[model samples]
Target: MKATLPRWADLALIPAINLLLAFFFAGLVVLFIGEDPIRAVRILITGSLGSSYGIGFTLYYATTFVFTGLAVAIAFHASLFNIGGEGQAALGGIGVTLVCLTLDHTHWLLTLPLAILGAGLFGAAWAFVPGYLQAKRGSHVVITTIMFNFIASALVVYLLVNVLKVPGSMAPESRNFAAGAHLPFVHEMLAAVGIKVSRTPMNLTSLLALLAAFLTWALIWRTRLGYELRAFGFSEPAAVYAGIDPVRITIVVMLISGAMSGMMALNVVMGYQHRLVLDYVGGAGFVGIAVALMGRSHPVGVVLAAILFGILYQGGAELAFEMPSISREMIVVIQALVILFTGALENLTRVPVERMFARLGGGG
Candidate 1:
């Protein structure tokens, strides 16, 4: 006789297991801090879902995570680790800001698409540099992309503080975007229909984020180029023998991944901040790697995982306010634990106690 689990069951198990482990770890932290873990958990849950404002914030944050997670997932499918999503996103934001600032258009219909296109192009260009280096010179993308991240951060800081500084403000951010360029929240539009809700930052960018995820799924599963990219990922030499050009695939895949990453800025520029700012990406690109890992590089999984993180991010901040002893940074610990459990799930079965139990139960 054989025992089998459905594919959806396996998928469900990952998050269930991850949450169980997270709770266990969070309990330990609560004990160390002399607080009630159950109370803390209750606060986190209730606070995050208690009001319209919380839900709005969660969706707003989710918008960025979805975009960046898809970007990382795309690169992961192609066997590329795009650590420079932070840089690419920042550069894209800068491009969009510059375009909006200079275009001086009265119509949002014209400016919005141009800004998005400009941002995507900027991100693609930034990613292509590392892709070119990796394909042509055999340089390690990990090192080059990390360096690019630092450069991008520094460059954005300089540009915002000095070069693009607004006329009268002392803040480290660009001038507010033109009113026409700002994205209106869905809640506001719905309010016009007599449905009242808290005006959260959720916007059209969220729709774009979902569209990008769908496009990524289609690109990976339905396209000839995607087939070649996956082949190169599995084995470059094998792909070469099959007449696939690894260099071209690498560059194209990276460019596409980077363009997706660049879209992350849509939330900040058009939806939230309405302009570029220092640390606008909010370390989202780095967190995107964890999202990809949690999602196992699947498009739908990435979207789900990104939403989970978004919930934690918005909820954790609220939790800090409700429970003074527990800092908002606790979310980071939860995220790290999720990553650890997913990465080492197989190793957990090898633990001596677990192995002994498995043997006794005939479950191994």
Candidate 2:
């Protein structure tokens, strides 16, 4: 059967409209609170993009989202809803910390590859358990993955408190990475090329995120494994008849997804925090689910959506700080509205758009 809407409309137009609707309603909320929505928007824009400093922070946040967003999108391609990104990312942080600590004397140029490998391995291993259960024991992936998030948290806490934490420290976090283990900041990299920019937490990891996005696109659309995964996602019975193994596909997809999620830790552990911190994932894992939904499960869409969210996050913080009247909680409510419109209420505009397109010869 032909799709009711064209690919362009499905991928771009619908999301654009949904975003506009989300902003419109969010404006209404601002009005109800006796604030000028237009002014609020201007502040958000200025905060997130107006200055080099703000832009740096925005890109940094977007980099983390890119990894998690791709993770969710990959799982979606295999008919899997792997919600263990929070846990996977957490474990990935552990992997990064372990590697960085182990190679404290090495140059960052040398440590990076090892850190990536460690993060991927730990995340993949963490995800393997849930995937194995789902494939071999009929355990639902959603339940297992979600449950693993808490388990991951507990495990990290235990490690930090007992094994990883520096002696005489009160915080439940590992010691800072050595000088050589520190990834260069984005501004430092730019300055090296003679371009002066404001400093922020953003770093070279953003480049890696973009490269990963490209790789994800290639994996999903150009590879045999991707074809098999998509075939299974589209129709399991047909894929099985075509000789695809559900167990293997399920496990492989989960591993890939988990690795992607785990790699997000690089942005925080290596680039920003330089240490293992509690709740470091900061719900980016959950946000990735919304990002994948908004992006229509495409790598490009995920990057774009992740940036949009990056704007909300960095901009929202500025909004609360400057406005004072809006408050941080209000900013969260605004962000929640975006998620609600983009994810839960996504179909609200779809039916009408489909009707219009159908009337205009959308039928194949």
Candidate 3:
């Protein structure tokens, strides 16, 4: 029987069902560990959303995920899997570092925009080579981007150890950025308006993340270029028949994807760490693929998915601390299960739903 679903059902309901199954299995894991799964759920919620401090950290993480998720989504629309978000984000940090080091003595108003431009430009440049190879040289983007991540890691390590390391410091990291380059913490920003939030790594960069999401929606759904990109994604031959240049579209989409991925560095490096540090990307890039999948590559869906992951991260930390039996390794298992069900096993639930819908339609 032919089976179909409304767009909203496909986007929202299928993912929701998959998520529930993931959590149910997660609860089973908790049960096997001799812990009350219900209590664990309670702790998870209370730990992530129960207090201002909790909420602050959650939002902080969600902010970064928003950038990386949107990055993946942008490329997915163009039929590209830009897995080098880690490297692109790291290069973006290099851009931020360069601008901050050169313009540190200036006012924040002067430094912030330049740093953003640097981050975006560096990120776009990093992706351009791969995009060009894919378009012009017939090189596979996946392999090249993955290789770039390792290269980026080695390059950053060399820079930190040999060039940017602070004098007499044992750590392999750059000096703390200047006060002018420091981003205001979310609590501080809130306090300025006579409201108060708990101290956390959350910062003004979250605003940038939100703005990126809105702009991504606009660029994807409300513009002619977006239509061309989607058309190219749907069928390159059809796009070519309609007079769109495949090479140009491919390169442009990757550039935009890289820039969005690079923006994640603004929060991690400039807003929180206040310095160039090793491993700053912290696997947020890889997590973004799952986010984009679960979100159906839509901006609003991406935001919600990001926030869900924020809950998982913050709540998982709390679970690890409160229930010592639930080690970090177990937390990783829980996260892996979520990723598995949502990504690799997504069709497991989808086929059943489709069959159910078919049966319903046939009966009618």
Candidate 4:
């Protein structure tokens, strides 16, 4: 039977309830560790949102999650699990680095658009191989993409070691990008307009993240291709019966997903790092899978989920610092609980609420 739920309930209430449940269990863990859960919650809130300083870092982290979350969310809508965001994003950093080295002296305005194209093309090409194998050779996308991730890591390492590394530098990284390539910080932009804010890594890429979310929403809900994609996702046989080309849908979805994942480099490498570096993605791609699950594969939900995680990252740091007993591993466990409930155990809350609504004659 189809479980009928109101739009608001499915999109908002269920996730909220799941989040609370996660925190409730996390609180118990804190108590077990001999800390007051309430105080910990307060510290969590304050550390991420209490001051401009904290907020800056929080938003900086959120910006990357927004991109990776959207990447995973798009693939989810098409019933494709694109687990290679890590590799795609790494390749994107290579794209950005090459572009910055060659065109940074020209001006940021000129460099950004070309960099976007390069990142998108590289990422899409990487994804296209897996999609082709899935559509033509019957190779499973999950295995192929996962394999490609390891390959991408090796490729990047080799490039840094042999090709892009600065002369005589022991670090496995390139030299700093030129001044023109430096992205203006949020504080600097605000200060230009006479409003002061705390300095942070947060930069113009945050705006691009929002724009990408909007574009994703429009593409998924308002386009004919979206209909075909959803139909394909719902049932491959049905889609083929309806004259949708399965191969085309599969390849296109992966391409779009890979492009979004690749764009994450814009924030980390271009905006914050200012040069290529090893392991710069910092597992945001994996975090995106959790974000996509919690968000129900919707763009707006992805944004909110991204922010929630940003809080966990920024606030978790402060929690460990202010109350050293809590420890970093405890914070990670708390985060794991959130992911566990939101992704794996979502139906735990969903089924009960659905039954309640059914009994009340409030749903179809």
> What TM-score would every model get versus the actual structure?
0.91, 0.98, 0.97, 0.97
Q: Which whole-number lDDT from 0 to 100 does residue 321 have in model 4? A: 97
lDDT of 4 at 243: 100
lDDT per residue as tens, model 2, 129-211: 99999989999999999999999999999999999999999999999999878999989988999999999999989999999
Expressed as tens digits, the lDDT of each residue in 232-284 for candidate 4 is: 88999999999999999999999999899999888888898999999998888
Query: lDDT at 262 for candidate 4?
Result: 90
What is the C-alpha lDDT profile of model 1 across 1-364, one tens digit per residue? 2224335534566456666776688778876888888887777676667788887788788889888888888888779999889999998898888877876356567777888898899889889999999999998888888999999999999999988889789998888877777777879777879988888888888888888888888999899988998888899899999999988998998899888888888788867788778888989998788788778788888888888888888878877887788886776787777777765563462244344544566333
- For each of the candidates, give the backbone clash count: 0, 0, 0, 0
Clashing pairs in 3: none
Candidate 3: tens digits of C-alpha lDDT, residues 136-250: 9999999999998899899999999999999899999999888888888989988999998789999989999999999999999999999999999999999999999999999
Ranking by TM-score: 2, 4, 3, 1
Error of 4 at 50 (Å): 0.7
The per-residue C-alpha lDDT of model 2 at residue 249 equals 93
- In terms of lDDT, the best-performing candidate is 2
Which candidate, 2 or 3, has the higher TM-score? Answer: 2
- 298 Cα displacement, candidate 4 (Å): 0.9
Runs in model 3 with CA error above 4 Å?
Answer: 362-364
How many angstroms is residue 19 displaced in model 1 relative to the true structure, after the best TM-score fit?
3.0
